[model samples]
Target chain A: MEFLLQLYADQTRWSTLPPDQAHAEMGAYAAYTQALHDAGVFVAGERLAPPSSAASVRVSADGKASVVDGPYPETKEQLGGYYVIDVADHDAAVSWAARCPGASHGTVEVRPIMAVPTAA
Target chain B: MNSRPAAYAVAERAARESYGKLLAYLAARSGNIDAAQDALADAFTSALERWPLDGVPRTPDAWLLVSARHRLFDRHRRDVRAERLHGALAAAARDAQRDFERAGEIGDERLAFMFACTAAAIAPEMRAPLMLQLVLGLDAARIASAFLIAPAAMSQRLVRAKRKIAAAGTPLPRVSPDDLSARIDAVLAAVYAAFSAGWSDPAGVDPRVSGLAVEALWLGRLVADIVPDDPETLGLLALMLHADARRAARRDSTGAYVPLAEQNTRLWNAAQIDEAESLLRRAARARRPGRFQLEAAIQSAYAEYRFGREPAWNAIVALYDGLLRIAGSPVVALNRAVAVGRLRGAPAGLLALDDVAVRSDLRDYQPYWAARADLLAATGARAEAYRAFERAAGLSVDPAVRGYLLGCARRLGTAQPSAPSSASEGKSPG
Candidate 1:
């Protein structure tokens, strides 16, 4: 099964950390990604730009499209990053997600990737 | 008739012990828990019909497994024929034959099934209901009654929870020990719920609920046996055992509901008490005392009263303080007042009672009124005590408890001797 672990945290938390601490955290994440790669379970993952860089696109009832600055209505924690990992089951995915450095002070919402049926 | 009842007793015992084990074993192997449970239920029904005549199988577990496997094979063949007909018949027959021959290789998988039922990925509220259904083989209605929910709602919740579990995939034997610990709290809560359902008098509506308490105890033992060093597991087992030990003493000779204070101490089950005490000691030695362990320690203090020792009011009050710190339920707070009254007089107990926030929270609560009446009567406030007793009696569901409360109201000014007590929330205290 493949699970998408969407990590979320306060956008300012990383920026407020001391330079050396942020750098150390980056190093830890690099090690974590490397570990996932070593285990051959990592499919794809990436960090996102802060919520300030995010743009929300909405379509009106009449199909008029409008772009808005920042997240849609904002939230306490912004989407920070995500990891897509192929593992045996949900628990394995949860174990892997728990090991992520961001999960120490953030949230990782694990959603199973919907399986698309192949052509017979 | 005698033989029939005896046969039923044997079947009941076997069902209590082997139902989960066999279902878990078959489900683990077959990978279709629903089908496995259906087949196992059919097997039990067949046993009810055939056991008395066949003189009960020498190995009921093996007999049930063999029957369930046949049922599974029949289900598989029916499904296969519905889809592909003769194309799959030969292969399916071979597979079924192989599975039947390999039945002896199946080991107990209930512990793993328990973890799966209480998996952290499942919603917290649904975990206990799921455990009751899948692990203990309780029907949705019985579980609903235990939880005071509509059976349909419980059934829907159970189906959703099962769907979630099935989607998660039962990763048999792959759960790490540390990961198992993370989910232990939910698992323990489920077991405790099972025990409580069994312990409570459900107005004699369902006798089967009573047997489930014993099964819950077995589950606690199984969990404790699996994780012997986990203090909470041991503590939970001790707590259940301690409560169960007083089952005999909970009623008078004429079968009236006797309060712990009024019951003859000699009626309490000594062996169960000893076992609970040892379990409590083990939990204490682990130095990881939690809510259940603290509660067990309080029960242990009450159990001391049976042996001619003064009911350890001081130790019980202290334990209640510790329990309040950890559990902090209003029920525990109310219970603590009884011990406080015993130790520091009725005025102090009433003061302690006042400190409990949200008095309106317990307006409909019978124990609160009962405790209030006890305290008032102790302080020689006959009129107030009588009113409180009337209120408690009005709210009480148990006829015996109602009679006891009413008796207190009738004996207003005479000042009857305050009986020795046990500190519990609703039911007869441990």
Candidate 2:
């Protein structure tokens, strides 16, 4: 099954670091991808920009449609970037998710992709 | 080393020894890497299926190699029996079997097989397949699966490659020490290609994919030893070794994603950093002037900065400047933009990014958006930053990375810092 492991961090925390510190920090991200790709375990990965570019929209109590440039939220945490992995089982998926650099501070939601049916 | 584990080890060693032997035979007989791998795989599967019952052949390798090679001929003859006269196929098989029967005799058949597979007559792309098949002696089943092609189709490519070489009179491309410079790049390129094939984890979703990096690095070192003074060759080796240094700490204790800045600095490898430092120094000192030298320097600087020290930023910037003069590719410019971000703060860095050519060649590379989005976010353009993050998220193949970018977008939507009237004045690049 394909599992999408989503991980995120606050952009503000990282965005304004001195360039040296920022470059140092991005090394971990590069290393992370390199580790997986080296092990032949990495399906795919990439780095992202910050959060202010987001737009959130939702239908309110009035039942009206609202559209925002970012994404709608569940409580405080929102949908960040994700990794789609074709692993053998849930245990492996969880193992991979736990390795994400942001796991200590943020949440990683692991969900299986739904099989679409085309029944007549 | 004498127990149940020992017994298991002994058995495993025996299997590998026999397997390698069978591969040697196949490589010799097939006249190319692909066909050799196919025949070797058939031998291996037959062993796996029959070993439990027959208790492993006394000369299991010879038995399997001869059996698998001849069995394939049997099938070919059976399929094309109507044109019995064209059994020149059988003639080659008979001749090969006779030669193989003499046994334990050698004339560098494996090396020649490799040369044929990596023959210049074949396209550049097929060289890795040939090496992975002939040099490493991996089976066709595994190699084919890794490349994500049908076995039959892969077999045809191998056969066609072999036939082309056989017809070309077996003029093996030689790289004597004097003329090694040009050929060394091609050789290194093949090694890089091998790792690239495995990097996507094409065959299975298992951790087995990482083995490709090991293979590539090993091959890189092998070629390096053959021609030691080649700087770019050493640079590729240093770069891979340095990149591979962080294998253990990439994930968290729970295996979730970990960004580099957030990763436990304690876990980064000192040994790898030292190795990279020495190698980068050696390559740079040689003054060979090549892309590998600059890229390795860039990465070496990155590895050093992992410790929170201001690295040789000026030297790295100089290296990128050299790269622009040499390759003039947008990717280099984009990377140079990061250095600009460091040397002259984010605004100047943004200007550098803006100045980079991104019309057709680099419109789709994810790193470009990632860099642009960083610039926008730094300057308080949150919405545009989010859009750039989204593009980066979609363009990359890595799951962890995509998830990370998406997280960045999510975090920005929920959190906002005080807007700086002048982002250029916010933080010094130093």
Candidate 3:
């Protein structure tokens, strides 16, 4: 099964960290991603840019689209990154999620990817 | 000739006994518990419809399996995923037929289904209810009542859990040996949770919650049968059996709560007690003591009272010490203190209780206050004891237990300090 692990954390904290501490944190995440690759379960992963640089788009029912600066309805824990991995089962996905560096101080939500049926 | 009532009885028996085995087999093959359950329900309906007219089948389980397989085939034929499921169902049906001819018993894939129910991906709170439904074939409403959840919400939760299991492709019968012990622990914890939920309602007054304890016992026996060599599995069964053996004596003729120490020994089930003792001995021979074993050993110490002997408080306290080292919680510490009070004087027990009183989790726990009240009254602190009794009664969920605690307080109010005595409390030494 395939799962998406969404890492949620305070996006602003990264800018205020000491250079050495920030480097160490980055190194921890690099090592975690490397471990996932070594385990042969890594599909794709990326650290998302800060929410301040992102935009939210909504299509109104009147066939008009509206765009908003920054994430809509800003929250304390912003979406920081995500990883899509293919594994044997949900338990395996959960184990991987626990090992993610973001899980130590943030939340790693594991969601199984829906399987789409193919027509013959 | 099979009358309608007799047919119904046979069908009910089959549903109760073979539901898990049949569902496990179907779900393992189909990889979708929701679909498998529907297929099994259809099979039962067909049985009810046909059995009365054609008489019961010679092998009811095999008959059900064959019928459910046909239902699965027919249901899949209309689906977009029919081709893949068709292949799997054909293979499953062949295996079922071969196994029936060879062993005359359905394949026992229940362990796999049980582990799947308690998989790490599932929410911790939902594991027990999911196990009750998937492994034991309990309805959502019955399980909802036992867990004190709304029926509709429980049904939704169960449906989502089943969907996740199927979507995640949790491998059946593929649990590695390295992960076996950990997975077994999760499964054991879920079963114990169900048993405790049921055990709390000793009076069994509510029709919805009444049969949960019995269903949990059946689940325990199924687990013990599957993993016979796992000492902790045997230990859990022994623990539940020890408590069950005292079920009848937990209440008096007037339906008042009777504490373990004051319960009438003659009303206890000797047969179940003997079985528990034997299982505990078997667990001891393995020399791998876990939390369940230690807890069972403590219960065994209390069972000595059934034979007209004083409970071995020393042994119980020592077992609690071991338990504290492993699975220390405020509840376990509170229970240990009660045993300490039994071994030493009320003052020593009070000191032990003080150590656990610092924990915030036990602030509203009824048993802790009840234990404190018992020790306070023993030491002749009438006012403090009365307040504690009232607090415990306020926290109690069971009316019988609350009434007993209030009665204790009332007695303390009317009696003289010179006549101070510790009244019995309910279900000590957890």
Candidate 4:
């Protein structure tokens, strides 16, 4: 089963960290990604730009479009990054999620990717 | 057997006896639990329909296996993913044919299937419920009630879990010896959780909650048989059996709660105690101690009372000390404090209880309050004991236990010859 692990952490905390500490944190994430690759379960992963760079978009019933300045439903913790990996089950996804550096100071939410049915 | 009722009884008996074995064999072969379950359900439906008209087969299990195999083939043939499923079904059919020739006995892959249920990929909380459904053939509603989950939510959880198992391709037979210990721990925890769920409903007023204890025992015994040398497995079996043996003595004839210290030893099942003792002895020979072994040893200490001897409280206290070192759970600490009270005195017990009172988890835990009340009463602190008893009674979910606690408080209040203070009469509101 494939699962999408959303890594959420407070964006403000990243800015307050000392330069060396931020570098070390990035190293930890690099090591985690390397481990996932070594396990042959890694499919795709990317660290996102801060929520400040994000825009919220909406389409109304009459097909009118509206754009907002920041991410939708502003919250303390932001979706800092995400990893989509093919693993055995939810438990396996959780195990990987725990290994992510974000889990130490933040949260790693695991959601199974819905399997798309093929046309018969 | 040609009669519909007779055929139904025969089919039901066969299902009860071999559902896990059949499902395990099918799922292990196909590597898809969801499909295997659907095929087996269809097979049972066919059995109910055909057995009366055609007469029950001499080897009902083999008949069912053949029926289920055909269903699997047909179901897959209609699927867009038939080519891939065909290979697995073909292999399963070959095994089914061999087993059919062997007559009544079907292959037992239940241990592997059970291990699959506890795979690292599955969520911890869902493991036991999934085992109950897939391995034991229990309906989701019954399992939901036992676990205190909403029926619809439980059904969705089970469906999603089954989908994951099918999609993830959990290697059933490849559970290597390197990870067996960890896997077995997961399996044992699930079984114990199931047993605890049933044991909590002491009165057995709900039919849904009552049968899980037996099913868990059956699962424990099955695991013990498959992993004969694993001491912890035997220890778990012993622990469960010791508790089960005392089930009859947990309540009095009047349906009042009977604490273990005052329970009638004669009411306990001697046969089950003997089995537990032998299993514990076998576990001890392994020379490796675990949480279950320590717990079983404590229960064994109490079982000595059945022999007309005072319980070996010293050994029990020592066992709890060992348990505290490993588990250190509030409940274990509370129990240990109670044991310390028995071996030492109320003051020592109170000191011990005070040590664990700092844990926030024990604030609403009824047994902690009850233990404190008992020790307070022992030290002649009647007023404090009365309040603690009231707190414990208010926290208790069982009506019998609440009534018992209230009775204790009432006794304490009446023991004083003077009219009770307004504070002591706090149990009643104006």
Specify the highest-lDDT model's number. Answer: 3
**Cα lDDT tens digits for candidate 3, B175-252:** 777877778988888887787763332111211223466677778888898888788898889988887787787679
Q: Per-residue CA lDDT of candidate 2, range B1-430, in tens? A: 3565555444444454465444544444433433445555666666655664456567655575577656667566676652243243344345555655675432233333444556578878678776775565555666664554445566677667666766765335444666667656666667666765633221111122334666667667755665577788888887667656655555568554454335565677778768767877788778886866666676677665476776565776788899889766665677677667767776887888888844334444556666676677777789987776665544433454555565565556778722211111101111
Cα lDDT tens digits, model 1, A28-95, are 56645755675578899999999999899999999999999998769989899998989887645655
Off by over 4 Å in 2: A1-120, B1-35, B44-125, B137-171, B197-211, B278-289, B357-360, B417-430
Residue by residue across A23-111, what tens digits does model 4's lDDT show?
55664565457556755788999999889999999999999999998888899999999999898876456556654667667988888
Selected candidate, larger TM-score, 1 vs 2 = 1
lDDT of 1 by residue, B1-430 (tens): 4988887767766664566776676555555566556677888778767776676777776677667667656766678643343223324323444554687433566778887787767876677677777766778888765654446677888888877766776544456777766667778977876776523321111112244567678789988887898888988898888877777776677755666666688887789889998988888887877888988888788777687777778888999899889788776787788789889988998898787635536654557777888888778788888777666654443445555565666667466635423312344234
Recovered fraction of real interface contacts per model: 0.00, 0.00, 0.00, 0.00
TM-score leaderboard ranking: 3, 1, 4, 2
lDDT of each: 0.69, 0.58, 0.75, 0.73
Instruction: Tell how far residue B208 is off in model 1, in angstroms.
Output: 11
Candidate 1 Cα deviation (angstroms), residue B235: 1.9
* Best-first order by lDDT: 3, 4, 1, 2
Colliding residue pairs in candidate 4: A91-B121, A92-B121
Tens digit of lDDT per residue, candidate 3, span A19-112? 9767646745654565566557889999999999999999999999999999977999999999999999765566567556676568888889
Q: What share of the true interface contacts does candidate 4 keep?
A: 0.00
Cα displacement (angstroms), candidate 2, residue B235, comes to 2.0
